[model samples]
Target: MSDPATNPPPAEGEERTSDASSTDETVAVVQAQEDEPNFTPITKDFGFLPIPKHLRHDPKHPAYFGLLLNATFGFAGTFVLANLYYCQPLLIQFSHTFNVSYDTVSRIPTLVQVGYAVGLLLISTLGDLVRRRPLIIMLVFICASLSIGLSFTTNFAVFQALCFLIGVFTVVPQILLPLAADLAPPERRATALSIVLSGLLLGILLARVLAGVIAQFVSWRVVYYLAFSVQYVVCVWLYLVLPDYPAKNKGATYFGLLWGMAKFAVTEPQLVQAVLISIPSAACYTNFWVTLTFLLGGPPYNYSTLVIGLFGLVGMVGVGLAPPLGRLIDSLVPWFASVIACVAYILTHVIMVGADGINVAAVVIVCIGIDVFRQMVQVSLTTAVFSLDPAARSRMNAIILISLFIGQIMGTAVGSEVYTQHGWRPAAALNLAWSGLMLFVVLARGPHVSRYTWVGWEGGLEVRKSKVTAQKRRDEEAGASDIQQRGDEKHALEAKQSVREEKDLQDATTVGMQEVKISETSEGEKQGEDQPPMVEVATLSAE
Candidate 1:
């Protein structure tokens, strides 16, 4: 006889069994999805691709394939976000081309960021509310159109308005970063985010370098033209080939989504503190980049745009190091990393304060240091925010990006106003203020809410309710309840046994009495019969 566990499956029944199991599993998955009221991931196909069911947005896909997809997203993000920074290096050129004051031209960068802030706030939440592919594609087309228009338009006012619109449309890449985090496996999510973020940082660096170099060879309008053409092609390819990932917040209305993000920013203390620290941190990074072009363009240094742009290449040293900083945030406590980063920020700012123009080496070294440390702080803080709510990853990211961009606006506005008016030293003083603010955010207090509430990773906010101790306490309570139940059962059994014994004893006594009465009656009957007959026992008793 074959053991049931070892028996081979029937060949014909295999298909039936597989089909039935798949059906049941699919139904169960649908039901489970319906039961969850909060944060249901969108899983339906766009009806565009006829690929196999398991391939699209399957978190269990091969790790290598996931990485490849992430890399694609990263590159896409780089190209899109590069639009924001290309104008930064071109500020001097814009001032010259438009025959405007440097101060007036500076508003172009600030307005672009302002549009970015508004767009980020408005469109950032769209990632969760709508289909990412169509939303992103729509934005791409608009950006492409705007880019082409910017290349041709001679009117400065129209060009300035287009800059804002360009900033709005370019946030497609911002949407993709949270998407990367969403699709990435939990074990590798941080690293995956870092890899994608590396593309973004590289784009920031190379946008200046490339813009500076390309503008030297041609006109700045060529930059927008190239971007427009390339983006149009990318948009088409993305529409045809990109896999659909549905929104988790598909049910939320537009107003509801934005309102919810605002609510999250206000309510979650970790998020609030994270934003606070990042504001100045962004101020520091953006101020340096925005002001550096001006500093190098003026004064004893009097560097050309190409040379100033090459300095962005030196900052590329920090770009390559970004992944390692992300890894550090993952491995170490994020709060600790943030504090150390804050210290580095302070020291770098001090170094910049001393560099009065002749010391190009100090400026270069300090700029590099500033980029690395500032990015580390950013990565650490961002990673810390992710721990607050995993289900709200997109919303959390929206909050984060919105907060950072707010700082971007601040930084750009400050750099444009202060550096153009009061010179570089006062600007450096503002950076020192940023560093001081970052340190205060780190060591001053913990979150008003709790930490370690979601992910188990260590962040700047470190509060965990003890799991092991709670388990032990629950076990003790259970043991005591079980002992009391058993004791009650034992007493009930003894009482039942005593009642059974008493019932049997009472039956025995009644039977004995009956037997004794029967014997006495028989003896009386015999005596009456012997004495002879008179109406039986009654007559005998009368006589």
Candidate 2:
């Protein structure tokens, strides 16, 4: 049999009736191909369980990213980000296990934070260059493998190395944040981001609780083993439920993306302000948490790992403030929210200074206050940074997060040293100073910088209105310039087209006149053949 596509021409009496049917089939094939998703699947089937239709990947009718997906992002963010903080509460156990000094073991958490910053710089930026689902899955699997290595390692060097690697590969949360921002509806984006952020905060707080309780009952190694299991479980969950998000910058090189982050840090004023604000806030936050373990574990409190970890539960009250604060940031100007949070942060540190290690109630209050204010600052700054550029969210996130972890590293290394050598008051004082600096930055660079004389107190509602009015005027000016440029180009093209049409009409008139002259000559020749012709006249017109 011959192929229909290469069929011979029809005979003289035959009709060509197959063409329309074949054309329809060809169109259907093209439509089917167009409707297919342009991504590679990690697996052909959803693993181990039945996936709801809404949860499954469908290119034709994308499911709305609803509560279940939000919950998945939250839980996954919690577990993945928890890996960084797990060893904070277990610093004592690590010191005892490694047969090292407190200062020596303290480097573990610091190194982990440094490694995480490095990962934010290097790996997290790939979210813009590659499909996020596979990248996320790969990172989680690597992190799980590192966790198992951490569990089995007896050598301090090996443990530190494994911890660093775990931190480096545990950037899944950073990748997920941009994905959530991409999928979430604009009206509900803040709520969605808050949900995931809440999970991250919970992970940071709850990881300690979980690690402390487990390490208190069993070996510290068991904590790693448990983390390993949980990471893999979350990894599988992500694999099954996560939607495939195509890369935002498909052809971008990794190095180009890295360079773009540096450029963004320099160019985007909001991003720069947010990073500056977040660095110190993160340092102060890390200082309290890292040093709190030492303060509670020593003299007056003398708490065990389990008791110390339970304080993370107290921090949960702060985590509860995330969604509300997210909504607040959504309603208010983000920098204004940051200003309020900075004030709360400074007051919290003042309370910390008064606690003096003897007042457990004051310490608990400080914990809750720090957690709440820290959440506020983070959500506000992030909202501001994310608002700057949709296409560059991953890179912008990396810039801010790298700064954040750098601050964490500073806190871990410096806060621990300060607590060890100078005592709790000095460490608290240092954090107070950082908080003061944060407030200063916010005031100078926040809402009404031009009109405000000192710490934003000098400016009132009038200052705010003036600022808004000036901003509006500037925006209108920019829009007007853009419109003017487009209009100029359009006018130029229209003028050129007008000239070409006039030239064509002139040429057509000339051709029509020549034709009429020729016809008149021919008519005169015919008249001469019949009789003596006096004069032949012709009237010509061009349309």
Candidate 3:
């Protein structure tokens, strides 16, 4: 048979055929392009603005490039958020240079964090309302410029307001986190979140220490100058590497984004659960460190301020433990891991209560253990919220960060007062109480398991198992129906054969009776051969 596809074209010079000829030519060109073996199209829109490719993903099919780039962006988040914390250690330097009281200088860190809370409510909402890549770029540029302006300001009030602006602009980490979670494959989403969180943790741990050391060598103003330079560098790098992730709530107004977040907090049980866990967790973490600095600075140890900053190194174990523990959530129920974290917090605080009463080694070990567990819980809970509203991940993240910073700010305020009034032991007791509250929250927020939702199994596996079992049940029913139909056919065939056998038997019996009659008549004729009335006798017998 001739192939229609390969057949020769007809003559194309007809008067009315020019339009058809042109259409055929266009289709042929398109088909040829499609058939070319090595042509791959670029679908991502990075040139104009970010429109995130919410590409459908399977747990089994992984993309290594996406994973690696996600990590790179996560690393960038560390430097971006570090701008918020660089002012913390410089407070002492600021007080000495400006001839201000300690209480007056403390307002710097407070204002910055308060500004961060405000920014969480305002600027981070833009991640949901505008393109995240360009939004990040614009925010960081503003931060870098402000940091430079801050270094030149001699007036205390101006400097304090600049710190606030710095806080407001250094929310790039908040935006980066949700985007990373969205870009990650379904199975690796938790791990990706953990890695990004580790960046945040790294920035938190090092920011104060790096600033204190830098101020030790150079002037405190230089630290802000350096921050300005770092932010500029980060802005350029983000422009090159960070592709656009489109806004989820594209049509929402500024006020609407804020309203949506408030509504979620009120109506979403999961968001409330996340807040409960985060409050105690952040309170314990911040209260411990801030109080520990006081204890180590004043007690039998009598450590220096720089030495107090060095204690952040003990929590470096968290930077390593974060991702593995996040993967642990991939296997176990997240609530179970959170419960473990809360219990760890309680026990560590208990141990610290007695040990801080004694010596330093025991306290250091307890701090490390608590830091590790706290980071794990953070990763678990954040991953959970990211899933709660995939469409509103950035806004969900804004809520988490706002809760966390508020907890930290409150913890520091209350913890510093307690440390000044009572001592380290009483503050330890207070933290212990907080840990117990966290444990209760975890229990209350635990997931309810249905029959298909067996504990300690991946959710994807459970769904696949349900589908397989349903298909098997369908197959079994179909097989049973086929067996029933075959049995009915067999019974019908048996009934037909029985009817034919009965008729054949009746026919044979009739033939045998006819043969017997003929034989008997022949014998009678022989016996009455001489009799003339044989025919009349036979006729009478027949009658």
Give the runs in model 2 whose Cα sits over 4 Å from its true position: 1-63, 89-107, 153-157, 294-306, 355-358, 413-423, 446-543
TM-score of 1: 0.72
Would you list the C-alpha lDDT of every candidate in the order shown? 0.71, 0.77, 0.72
lDDT of 1 at 503: 94
Which residue pairs show collisions in model 1?
none
Q: Over the stretch 1-543, how does candidate 3's per-residue lDDT look in tens digits?
A: 121123332333322122211222112222443466764433334456443342211122212225456666667777777877888888778998888999999888878888888888888878777767677888888988998888898898888888888888888888888777765544455677777888888887777778888899999888888878988898777766665443465457888888888898777766777788798788888888888877888858898876777888887888887767766765555666677777887888889888975788977887797788788778778866675666677788899887887778778888888878999888888788888898887665435333232223232323232243355567877999999989889988888888889889999999999999999999998877766676887999999
Q: How accurate is candidate 1 locally (lDDT)?
A: 0.71
Give lDDT for model 2.
Answer: 0.77
Model 2 Cα lDDT, one tens digit per residue, 1-543: 222213443444454342221222112222343466773322333244344444444433333466778789989989989999899878999999889999999889878877887898899899878767778888988888899998998899999998888888889999989778777544345667777888998898778778877887888989888889999999898877887644566577889988898898877666777788888998998899879888999989898866776777887886677767766665666678788899999999999998758789999999989888888888777766675666688899898888887787788778889989999999999999999988888766646444212333433433232245456567878999999999999999999999999999999999999999999999989987997434443223221
TM-score of each: 0.72, 0.72, 0.72
Give the alpha carbon lDDT tens digit for every residue of 328-404 in model 1. 66555566777888998999999888884558887898788887887788777776676566446667787888778
lDDT rank order: 2, 3, 1
